[model samples]
Target chain A: MIKVRNMTVAYSGQPIFTNLSIAFEPGKITGIIGPNGAGKSTMIKGILGLIHKQSGDVTLHSKPVAKQLKNVAYVEQRAALDLTFPINVFDTVLTGTYPNLGLFKIPSEKDKSAARQALADVNLSEFSQRQIGELSGGQLQRVFVARAIVQEADVIILDEPFVGIDMKSEAEIMSILKRWQMAGKTIIVVHHDLNKVTKYFDDLVIINRGIVAAGKTADVFTKENITTAFSGDLSTILFSDKEPEHA
Target chain B: MRSIGLFIDGLMQYNFLQTALITSILVGIMSGIIGSFIILRGMSLMGDAISHAVLPGVAVAYMLGINILLGASLFGILAALLIGLVTLKSKLKNDTAIGIVFSAFFALGFILISLAESATNLHHILFGNVLAVSDNDLITTAIVLAIVLIFVVVFYKELLITSFDNTFAQAYGLKTQLMHYALMLVLTLVTVTALQTVGIILIVAMLITPAATAYLLTNRLSHMMIVAAIFSVVSSVIGLYMSYTFNWASGPAIVLTAAVFFSLAFLFSPKQGIIFKKKIN
Candidate 1:
C-alpha cells in the first residue's frame, strides 16, 4: 500500500492543504480527481518527494517512498516535456531505462530491446525513428506512456495524462493501465473528467485543497461529497450529466 | 582554390601556423559538443553570460601571476552557480539573473584590468590573437578539451535525460540539480579553454552558432553534435586561412564563417529550413 500521513503542503506562505492523509492500496486504478488549484497534482508531487512537504510521511509498504523513488514510474503532464528536443521516439523511450542503467553505464542491447518492446506495446513501433516534435498530440502522449512502460516500476503515477489527446489515445492509455493493474502494480492518475471518474477508476481520491472524500468510486463519489469538494458550484455544472453514480 | 593549396603548404612549413591550426580545431570540437547541450537547454544566453563572466577571473589571475584558466574557470562556475541559485530562490527568471550578473562581472573585469600593472594585453584577451598561441596555451587547451570530451562521453545518457525532461529525470532518482551544476562546470571549462583561441567576445558565437546551425540540419542530438563539429572544424580552418592571408583577426573571421554556414542551413536545410517547408492548408 502507498500511504501519505499527516501531510501538509504550502506554497509561498499560503496553505494549500494541511494535516491531510490518504492511502492507496495495490491492485487498483486510482484517480485523484479535483477542480483546478485543489492540490491534486501537489499532493502527488509531495508524496513522490518532487515537491517539498512541510511535514509528511509517505510510505510504500511501511517504508519511506522517497528512498525508493526508482521503484516509481512517474509520467509528468504532457506539456512538461520539451517536444522540440532533438530526440527520436525510440530514444525518448530509451531514457526510461537510464535510471535503471545507473552511472557510467550506457543502454545495452537488452535495454534497447525493452525500449523497443515498450514502443511496440504502445503501438508506436512504426514511428520509432520519427522525431518527437513531429508526432501528433496523441502520438506524443503514447510516447510518454512507452517511456513509463520501459521504467518497469511497481507503481505508476501519471499527472493529467489524458489532456489534449484524442479519445482513441485516451481509450488506449486506460486499457494499457488496466493491464498494469491486473498485474498487481499500483496506478495513480491525477484526473479531472467527472463523467469518466466512476467508469475509469475503481478507487477515487477527491480533493478540494484537502481530502473531500477518498474510497471506492461507488462509495465516496457522492453528490454531496463532490458538491463539498467543488464547493457546490462546479459540482452542479460538472456533475449534471453523470451525477457521480451514487451522488 | 589556389589560395587553399597555398594555405595547406603554409601549414606544413610554419610551426606557428600549425600550432594555430591545431588549437583552433581542438577549440572547435570542444565548443561544438558543449554548445549542443547549451542551445538544447535553451541556455544560449547563459553560455554568453559565462564566457563574459570569466573576464574578471582572467584579470585577477594576471594580477596574481596565476594560471588564467584556473581563475577563469572558478569565476565562471561561480557565476553559473549564482545564476542558478538566484533563479531558484527568487521570482527573477534565468535571463534576468544572467543580465544582472554577467554585466556586473564584466564591469568589474575592466576595473581590475585598469588597476593591474601587468603586461597582459586586454585587447588580446578580449578579441583573441590565435596566431600568438604559445606552447603552454596549446597544452592547456588540449588538456581542457580532453577532459570535456571524456565527461561528455561518460555522462551522455544522464545529460540527455536531464536536458530532455528534468522532472522525469528527478523522479527517476537522478539528481537534476547536480547534473545542472555539472553541465555548468563543463561550460565554464569550455569557456576557459576558448579564452586563448577565440577570446571572450567571440566565444559565445563559437559555442552557440555551430550547434544552432547543426540543430537546423539534424533531428537527433548525436547527429547535431557531429554536424556541429564538422561545421566548427571546417569554419575554423577556413577562417584561419582567411586570417593568415588577409591579416584579419582570427576570432571574428571564424565567427563569420559559422554565420555563413548558419545562413545556408537556415535557408536550405531539407527538414526545417524556411524555404523548403510545405505550407499547411
Candidate 2:
C-alpha cells in the first residue's frame, strides 16, 4: 500500500487539508475525486513531497515513499508541459531513466532501448523525432504514458490524465495502466468525471478540502456522498467529456 | 575587404587588440551557451535583472578595492534570491520583483560611481569598451566560458528535464529548486564576466538574441546550442571589426549584429521561418 498519514497541507498559508489521512492499496485502480478547489492535486503533491506539508508521513510497501522515489513515477497534467521546449518526443520519454542513472552517468544503450520499446508500446515510434508542439492532444498524453512505461515504477500516480485527450487515447492509456494493476503496482489517479468513477476506479477517495468518503467505489461513490463532498452542487452539473477549468 | 586585412594586422600588432578580440569571442560563446537555457526556461528577464543588478556590486567592489567578480556575483545572487522569495512569499509577480530590485541597485550604482576617483573607467561597466580590456579580463572570460561548458556537459540531462517540465522533474526526486538556484548562480557569474565584452544593458541582448535566433533555426537543444554559439561568435567578430574600422561603440555594434542574425532567422529559417508559413486563402 501507498499511504499518507496526518498530512496537513496548505497553499499560500490557507489550510486545505488538516490532519487528513488516506491509503491506496496495490493491485487496484484508485481514484481521488473532488471539486475544482478540493485540493486533489494539492493532496497528491503534498504526500509526494512536491509541495510543503506542515506534517505528514508517506510510506509505500512499509518504507518511506520519499526515500524510495525510484519506485515511484508520476505523470503530471498535460497543461504543465512546455510544448515549445527544444526537445523531441524520444528525448522526452528518455528522461524517465534519469532518476536511476543519477547525476554524472550517461544514459546507456540499455536505457535507449527501453525508451525505444516504450515509444513502440504507445505506437509513437515513427513520431520519435517529432517536436512535442506538433503533437495532437491524444498523442501528447500517450507520450507521457510512454514515459511512465519506461520509468518501470512500482507506484504510478497520474493527475487528470484524461482531461483533454480523445476517448480512444483514454482507453489506450487505461489499458496500459490495467496491465500494471495486474502486475500488482499501485495506481493513484486524480479523476473528476462523475459518470466514469465506478467504471475506472475500484476504490474512490472523494474529497472537498478533506475526506468526504473512502472505500470501494460501489460503497463510497453514492450520490449522497458526492453531493456532500461537492457541497450540494452536483444536481446542476452533468458529467461530460469537458472538464471544469482547473483551480 | 581591405578593412578585413587592416583588422587582422591590428590583431597581430597591437597587444590590446589581441586581448580585446580574444575576450570578446570567448564572452560571445559563453553568452550563447548559457543564453540557450535562459531563453528556454523563460528567464530572459531574470538574466536582464542579474546583469543589471551587478552594478551595485561593481560600485562596491571599486570602493573597497576588491575583485569585481566576487562583489558582482554576491549582489547578482542576492537579487535572484530576493526575486524568488518575493514571488514565492507574496502575491507579487516575477516581473514586478525584477523591476523593483534591478532599478534600485542600478540607481545605487550610479551614485557610487559618481563618488569614485577615475570613475570614468567604471562607466565602461555600463557601456562596454572592449579595447580597454586587460589580459586579466581575457583570462577571466576564458575561465567563465570553460566553466559554462563543463556545467552544461555535466548537467545537461538535469537541466533538460527541469526546464521542460518542473512537475515531472520534481516527482522524479530531482532537486528542481537546486537546479534553479544553480542556474541563477551560473548566470550571475556569466553576467559578472560579461562586464568587459558587453555592458550590463547589451549583455541582455547578447544573452537573448543569438539564442532566440538559434531557437528559430532548430528544434533540438543540442543543435540550438552549437548554432547559437556560431551566430554569437560571428556577431562579436563582425561587431569588433566595425568598432575597429568605423569607431562605432563595441557593445551596441555587437548587439546590432546579433539582432541582424535574428532578423534573418525570423524571415528565412526552413521550418518555422515566417516567410514560408502558409496563410489560409
Candidate 3:
C-alpha cells in the first residue's frame, strides 16, 4: 500500500538514486537488500520523509505518507541509539505509545497496559526494569521490537534489525514480523542475508543505486539480479552460501 | 579555621550574602537538571562550547548598553545554530565545527570587551564573584529555575525519548530538531543566569561534573537528575562556606567542590566505581 513515486534522493548534493519508483505490496514482508552504499537505507528513509527527497512523493492508502506517520513504525539500526542513556526497558517500550498520544498529554493507563503486553510478547517482562545499558545486543534489539509492537502500527519498517543479533533473537524478531504480516500489516525490512532470502522475505527489492530488480522472491531474487546488484565479477566469488554481513 | 563564626554571622546579617546563597542554590539545581541531558546525549563538548560561546553576547550587550540576558541569549542560540548549520552543510565533523565556532565567538568577545572599555570587571565575567550577586540576579536565577522545572516536567517523555534515541523519536513524527533547539535555548538561559555564580569559563564544570557524577551513581534519568541536583546544591553550600571562611574565589571554590564529588563518585560509587569494581569481581 506504500508507494514511492519517481523518487530521487541525494545526500550532501550527491545523487544516490534518481527517478526511482517502487511500490511495496501490502500484508507481505518485503526485504530491501543491496550491496554496500546501494541506496537501500537511503531509499526507505527518503520515502518515509526521515531524510530529504530531491523529488517525489510517497503515499499510503491514498494519503500522503507524511500525514500518516502515526500509522507507520520505523526502527532504525540499533547501532544508532545511545546505549548509555538512563532509561529502563519498560519506559523505552512506552515511547511507542507517544506517537498516538496527543500533545501535552502523557501516556494513559491503557497505553501503559499496551507496553506491558508488548514486553510480555517479546519475553522481556522480567527485564522491563533493567537499564538498556545492561542489555545484550540481542536483548536490546528485542527491546526496540517490543517498542514497535506497542505502537500497533499498520506498517512496520526496520533497518537491519537482525544484523549482529544472536540467532535466537533473530528468529524471535522474524516470527513477530511474520505474525504482523498475517495480521495484514505491511512489513518492509532493509535486510542483506541472502542465504535466508527465500525463507524470510515474501518479496525482494534489490538495488545498486537503482532498483536492479523487483517482484516476488521466487521471480526476481534470481542469479542474474544478484549478479547485477552485487556487481557481477566480484560477487561470483563473494556470494558464498554463508550469510556474511553485507555492511 | 578561617572564620566559620564570621561567615555564619554574615549569613544572618548581610542581604548580599543571603542573595548570593539563594542564587547559588537556584543555579546549582538548574545546572544539574540541564547537565544530565547534555552528558547523557554525549554532548559534553557542546555544553562546553555553548557556555564559552555566550561570552561575545555578554560583550555585545555591554557595548549596546542593554540587558546582558537579552544579548547573551541571542548570541548563544546563534552560536548553537551556526555550529549545527556548518556541520550539516559541510563535510567537517561536529567537533571541528564546534571548535571553530565557539573559540571564534570567545575570541570575538575578548575583542569586543576591550573595544567597549566596560566598567564591569573582566575577571568577574570570566571567573564569577558570587559574593557580589545582587537581589536582581537572584530573581533572574529563580525565574530560570522555574522555566527549567516546568519544561522538564511537561516534556519529560518527549525529551527522554529524543535524548535516548533521536531517530526513533523522528520516526514517529516527533520534531527532534525542535526539541534539540528548545534545549539549546534553555541551555542559553541557564548559561546566562549562571554568569554571576559560575561565570563563563567554569560554567562547563557546573554543567558537566555534577550530572556526570550522578550518571555514575544512578541508572534512571529522573534519579540522575535528582542526585545531580543534590550534589550541585551541596557543592554550592560548602563552596560558599569556603569562599566566606577563606579568601578564595567563589566560582573556583564551587567548581572544585563539584570536582571533589566527582572524584569521590568515581572512586566509591557502589554500582559503578573503580574501587567497587575490584570488590565485585
Q: Per-residue alpha-carbon lDDT of model 2 for A1-247, expressed as tens digits?
A: 9888999988777999999999999999999999999999999898778988999899988889888887889988899778998889999899888878889887899999999999998888999999999999999999998999988999999999999888888998999889999999999999978878888999999999999999999888765787788855573353222345312
Clashing pairs for model 3 are none
Ranking of candidates on DockQ, top first: 1, 2, 3
Return the DockQ of model 3: 0.72
On the 0 to 100 scale, the lDDT of residue A111 in model 1 is 91
Q: Residue-wise lDDT of candidate 2 within B86-107, one digit each (tens)? A: 8877788989988998888888
Q: Higher DockQ: candidate 1 or 3?
A: 1
Tell me model 3's lDDT, rounded to 2 decimals. 0.89
User: Between prediction 2 and prediction 3, which has the larger DockQ?
Assistant: 2
Candidate 1 stretches with Cα past 4 Å from truth are A231-234, A237-247, B278-281
The best candidate by TM-score is 1
Q: Which ten residues in a row have the lowest lDDT in candidate 3 chain A?
A: A238-247
Candidates' chain B TM-scores in the order shown: 0.96, 0.96, 0.97
Candidate 3 Cα outliers beyond 4 Å, as residue runs: A231-247, B1-5, B115-118
lDDT by residue (tens digit), candidate 3, B1-281: 43878888999999989998888999999999999999888889999898889888888888878888788889889999999999998999999999999999999988887877655778888889999998777887888899999999999888888888887778778899999988998998999888788788999999989999999999899999999999999998888889887868999999999999999999999988999999988
